[model samples]
Target: MMLSVIIKRTFVPGGFPIKYIDEIFKAIDLLNVDSKYVPREGQENLMLDIGEAMQGEAVLMAEAGVGIGKSFAYLIPGLIRSKRLKKPLIVSSSSIQLTEQLVGDIEAVSQILSTNFTYVVGKGRTNYLCYARYKSGNKHKDLTDILTLQEEWKTGFIKPMEKKKWCVDNCLFNQCEYRNSCDFYNMRQNLKPRYTSSVDCIIVNHNLLVEDLKKKVKLHQPGLIQEGHSIVLDEAHKFEDIVRDAFNIKINIKMVKRMERAIKDLEFDLGLNLKTMRLLTEFLEDFNRELIKIYAIEGKYILGNRLDIKELMSMKFKDMNLLLAKFNTMKSELRYLDFKDSKEKVYDELDEMIGTIIDYFESIGPEVSVYWAIYEKIFDVNGLALCSAPKEINKIIYELLFENQKSIILTSATLGGNVPINSAINQNRAYYEYQTQALGLPESTIYSTPQKSPYNYEENTLVYLPSMDIDVREDSMSNDIANEIIQLANIMDGRTLILFTSKKQMESVYGGMLLRKDTFTWKLLKQEDNGSVNRLREEFSSQKAVLLSTGAFWEGINIKGPELSCLIVVKLPYPVPDPVIKYKASTNPLVHEAEMMIKLKQGTGRLIRSEMDLGIIAILDHRIKAKKYILQSLPFRNVTEEISVVKGFVENKMAQYLSEQR
Candidate 1:
């Protein structure tokens, strides 16, 4: 097959002493060929090249444009390397949803492709259900809280899918009776665990990868990664900023309230007597007081009185250590009525409860440093936790690649520009190093990355920039933007998708448009009340809806087919001074600016997922003309080209492009 020829040449290049091109081809041909499951030529070629590149211990950045089957492009190489090299493949993505999707997709595709590869998925230690907490109900109040939460989850009010990854520290993974039946553990076993099961290619997020890297360095142990494995970062661009956030620390009052409420609920559920209830209430008050004191010492941005927030937090945590000892001692000394096993169950549960609280304190104590700061709105005197990450992601790449000598590949749809941690791939390396030393690296090195798109970008895409000079006096800029969308929508009819920077703006535009009231019929969908992006995309594809959304809508959304032929950008999606951004900006300007850049790129990447998937993208912001930075390489060249396509669509030349397609 054409694929075998390419794969053979890749592994056994000319002039190599160990060339095995002929033998390799024959061996691979022994595998049954399922014509229907064979990848397209473009995908096969790219996968073969990526596999060859990794075999040399070279890190490759494959920029597979949206929907070019990127997951498979990398998966084939990862699976092949895992089996051939006898190492585990760790695939990390930017989101939990993608992590779950990767696991499922890999399993589903493997069956069809006849690749008998085993796989496993793991999250942070907190994700599992704590057996000790489950049985003891006395110690960890959070278990009761989660049960209450599960009730709400069943009603579809809150999704616990993401939260299921972090349970508590008291969980004993090896001893759990459910280990064999657990969904996560079962998935791990399915990966075909061999005698050397120490976590081969672990699927992790940028946040977790960065966290582990920090831990590895702090612990001064490179041996932590000695397990036979390589790393594959799926959405690599996010590596930079995620490392930054993962290193810094912050705590919110909402979490404290959640803890307090859970404690009270546990008290009631356990049916404690008035005396015991009083003692528990007093204990919570003490816990609250101690938490505040700790926050004062740790959460502050600056240190004062010779004790920085970190030191103060450390002292406070030590005090908490003492308090837990005293609390346990008192519980043993005071005798209460021993009733039926149910009452005894509640009493024993409290012991487990103390263990849970102690676990949180211990986990935070070593991994996070305490800081003292004022948290607006939530707490007047909030103590925070913080951790400073390594200066560069190269430290991580170094451990994953050089120290481990395992194959690593980084791929993303938008890796070239400043991309958000949640959506696009970000560069974690410092700018000065990138500017000075990056140029010297090999084309296969960290500096010189590869572009893996399926189409000629300049020819296939044109960026359209509409005039942003709106009269500030007229409350009609939104109206005008809506009108423009309507005009473009008519041009493409049912095949247009309009993305708003804000839901309020989306509402305003949709409300202002009058054409859709008559024979100008088209499906109009807006992201109302926090709907899942996957569900929205499903609806958009099935019913060609003009989907309107706020923040999450712009990135991580995929829509194709005749339903979404055009995308309208209402404005340059500069983030508002939202609480979280504002909070971070108040303390660190550079980090905030980096975050804004990342967000902007993510917003623009919503259109033109693949080479064959064509669409007109219009940016209704005059900022392109006024601000020179908007024209810079920040948003990728596709943004510039897509603007031209939007202009062409409105100018009646869309017909010409259609004829070309025909």
Candidate 2:
């Protein structure tokens, strides 16, 4: 099975051996500054292991403690490898914060190594500014504000992509009339598509990297990763989600609505009696219910009746595409006349909807993939859409990403160890390894290590469980969790991070705490109330704020100060039986349980970010005890059931934190 995938899979033999020990030690020493920088032996060893692993062309599956400097550890190796080989190293992170952190770290490490590494920040189709759309100016107030504001710059660089309706596939590039003056045109040439550049390092979020991976695999497009380049996935714990997202082809509700509006115009002009469009719309609406069923269990390999498209085409109506095609042709003609201004809304709607409908047809044909469609009628999200993915994600990653690559580094603070915790916990770890096993390189081709955090957890942190042993399933459980949080907030008195599994639960407790009026003298910021996660993180870091957020906020927002002295766990972070988890869990409950523990560890990893910072982890839910294997997931050295004394412990820490300030 030869793939046209490789433009450059050939590695330079004996280009550079892993003999950079002195250089590594010296770089670590230089980075280990007295000004808020403490060098740890764990970090140094990890960096050495990573450098050797890259030199050996091995997959280094490593887990480091919270303060092990994992970013610098892997990054130093990657930068050195790229510099040594004269080839770029691709680094992918899961979160924006981590990406930003890596960029900053690269700057600092560049000083240590005294090597100028040219790295490209890969922002896929969404992030780039589109010059065609800006000129179209389809009644958007922001577009107007951008045009007026952008006149001051050499190019209207500030007027980037449309945040709501970004269509990267349809970009005209050099073909547009304003191509010379276009922001996107200049950016595409100057900023991005740097595979041909001498600089071999590129940094991207998991989503962008996965998208590029898909482009190479499915479309055979030579994207960011080229010949002889290696990839290091930092925050590698989020690989499963990346795997899911890479193959996820979603047909959104907005696309359907646009198609509907376009159909109305097509009927007005051509009068084709778009009964097929209405039927397609109904199919989308019903598709939502069908998706929920599949998501709750295992994914649907084939869904919504075997004869779905067959029955639809036989309904004495034209095909859906034919109707949309006619509308687009009529739109072009309307532009020639004066009616384009009057029908600009319809014209733009037709363009957006046409692209979306085509995307749906291409993805949801149900001939080659497994898929599900989701629908939500809410204030923020309203519409129905279908999502599709290939059946084997691990296999694809292994063959495409690892098999031909020289070296791959997978590092994260919370990548659960391969060591079996218990029978049940081991099952989840096995499942995790199984999903990642698709990389399929020889055992000798990869390296694996688990580096413990150097922080003094026993002295700096307490894992406090409720003394009352309240059941998580009870109807009054919300009140119990909220009550504990309110008291803990007042006692901690500086800042707190409360992790929740769901927004509904967070809302219920958030509203309940506000009703108490004396929950604390400090302010409570809900994730929903904050316009952005970055804003929420910034506010929480600045004030005595209790930040409430869910899954996405689990790992990245690192608040490492005495002010962040307490972490409250509202519930055991379990895998909600979403289709992927449900199917995997059906075969092995241990895998599901292990997944929960990994998430729990990620939340707890937030506390005691440094040895000097002391804090307490209060688990409101008693489920952690019920599942004895769950204890294996917890990173805390001292677990206490006595919730009464936790108040005193946190109070004394808070006093000390405040006194140090005085």
Candidate 3:
């Protein structure tokens, strides 16, 4: 039974009902009346494809290039589907910033389409302030100030309060006196099916979505997100890493100390002579000491091979089993004692935590998971942690998401790998092959041909690869890169962003620039030296200054106009050869280069943010020249190896910019 026949409507070639396509076209026409909206062919095509996928209950992987207006394209279809089906649509993104942006886009789209559907922004439990924790503590001054302002805050999500010790997970849930007024509790209630009929869309970060799936799939519980909902994963390139992190198990000193505290609290409350509890605490202390002996270094180290696991188990397993027996004995005693409900819950939670740790330890092996040990300082307090993460998350992703959801759409600007520019041979599948395999989507998953950005890259951007003969490993590399940056920044008058893969290298180059400060007229700013990333970006936008940064600045940054005319890449962002990378490399030797190409595309994307924007992207590392696939991955068409060409482009663009200002 074809969907078009079942619906008894004329259908488009892509399987979208003709009426739905007409409605989308009408909405776009209405939107185009606004001065800010430009009707893009690619955006319309993407919207139709997404609508077709939703109607067919299929998985879709779309690669929408930057400036293709991807947000509006997906939002139009997502909102229409939710309204038509009378079910909620879930949108998951990788970061808080992007989630917020999507919420704004959804609001704007709903107004234009006149759908008038309700939506809610969903974040993790920790993201919201637990009213019980707020009322229970003498807060730090910084926390106190934020809480004061939270009175007027509608979301109750103070960014600074995230990951703090006294929050939702640490608070009493329904038992708390503040339950009625609790923001976290109320938000949870809003997601229930009874309350969700009016809610057409739910926007959340990837972590919260994964947590919901885990609850539904593993715990036989109603999920935080309602079942049978279609999901749209924006920034889908980052989904794999987020899922891996969500599933990994860790046993840190803090966790053990919390268990000890719970035991002591229970003993006091129950007024029981729990000698075994005392011995359990002592055994935990001994276990920490043993871990410290093995993981003496203050850094991350991979724990490989079954022999290492056997040795650790031999030293600690006997004591752990003895404590487990004692804990079970204590649990039996608890059945006879009339304890408070809260105390009973705490005892059960502690039991589960300990049991999970034991199970995780038993499961440690190279074939199933990757084990690692970390000895680091948290808030100046030294702590040791043993962690285990799955070797691959593809199967889990498929089972939890693709298999269960009615429809799922994974879209990102860099979702696809290198597809040669202007190639016509199965470009759709070839472009998405890496991501489809990496994410474990079905073989029949629909892959949209990559949507091209409307921005004129050939006329507005230049790809500059300096002919400098310097390796990243050389001691003189920082100085040499600094010298090249000085020349380029001088030509652009310091509207430049110098991106580095290494903090040590960035600092060295910053130092070099300081020594030669008089050689250039622009003010120099380094990340963390002046202020936060946002503050530094704001300052750079307001002045002709060069900013040196790494990490977050590599992607999800938008700087338009003359303030950012040049971008300098210190080196290709190759994945650091950690245990995870090593494992991935063992399975696929080309994964490293593939990752580098994706990151290189992201970094270069920071340059031309709009049609009016003109910039030059300079790759200072000579290594990029060897990776021929990079040219195909990047968006720019104008390539040059000479500094003179960069100067010419900068001068012409500057002249054009000044004339436009006049």
Candidate number of the best lDDT:
3
Instruction: Score each candidate by Cα lDDT.
Output: 0.51, 0.64, 0.73
User: Per-residue lDDT for 1-662 in model 2, tens only?
Assistant: 11221222232234464365446656766777635568777787677777767766677777778888888888887887787777778889876567777788888778777878777665555554455665475545555654554442222122221343433445666567767865556545643454435774777878778777777877798777776777888877777667766666665656555566665654444344255455555655554554444344433312222212323233423444564564455445544544335566666666555554555455444445445444333211244445666545656777667766667888777666442434452343342453344334345444445677888887777888877877765546777777888877787774789998876678777778878866468878887522455556777887787877776577766777766778888888877665555445655445565677678888888877777788888888887776665665455767887765777666665566644521
The whole-model C-alpha lDDT of candidate 2 against the native structure comes to 0.64
Off-target runs (Cα >4 Å) in candidate 2 are 1-15, 29-36, 128-144, 147-170, 175-187, 190-196, 257-275, 286-370, 379-382, 417-445, 586-590, 659-662
Q: Rate residue 193 of model 3 by lDDT.
A: 62
lDDT of 1 by residue, 279-377 (tens): 434443454465466544444322211122344455556555765565455355334434455444444555544444444444444533222333332
TM-score attained by model 1: 0.60
RMSD of each: 9.9, 8.5, 5.4
Can you rank all candidates by lDDT, best first?
Answer: 3, 2, 1
- Any idea what lDDT model 1 has? 0.51
Q: Give the Å shift of residue 348 in candidate 1.
A: 15
Better of 2 and 3 by lDDT: 3
TM-score per candidate, in order? 0.60, 0.78, 0.85
